[model samples]
Target: MLIMNRKRMVEDKLDRLTKGQTAYAESRELIRLVKREIQNRQIPVLMDETDSGCWFIPQKNTTTPSDEQLAQM
Candidate 1:
């Protein structure tokens, strides 16, 4: 009975560790996908760090092509 209890405790701990790792991996993948999308859209992002945490600021579009340039494209 004692051996069975020990085995169950070990399995429970392993399960918890596995779940934590899976969550971490999923979050990393999500961040990668978001970064890829931002790059693909050519969005300008400025990062700032403060005492608390980092911040992402989206810059304005100041270099839009003129109508003539668009027409040529």
Candidate 2:
């Protein structure tokens, strides 16, 4: 299939690119760049799952009312 061929081509090119570099260094750099790109793309499902814990804070605690505390008046 066309998709399979393209995947093969990309794999080939990546293999060629890393062939000259040391295995450990090349693999570490490749992993870092791939993770950076994935983060930059900001995929919704990935973003939600990655941030599910920290981004969800209680709505009432998000804002403080200075007027209620007699500070704004």
Error of 1 at 64 (Å): 12
- Mind giving the per-residue lDDT tens digits that candidate 2 earns over 1-73? 4333433433443343334321111233334443344346432211112322211111112355577677646
Q: How does model 1 score by TM-score? A: 0.34
Q: Among all windows of ten consecutive residues in candidate 2, which has the lowest summed lDDT?
A: 51-60
Best by TM-score: 1
Candidate 2 TM-score to native: 0.25
lDDT of 2 at 29: 38
Kindly list the per-residue Cα lDDT of model 1 for residues 1-73, writing each as its tens digit.
4333433433443343334321111233333443454466555655444444333455555798999999999
lDDT (0-100) at residue 28 of candidate 1? 38
Model 2: residue 6 alpha-carbon error in angstroms = 17
RMSD of each: 15.0, 15.8
Give the TM-score of each candidate.
Answer: 0.34, 0.25
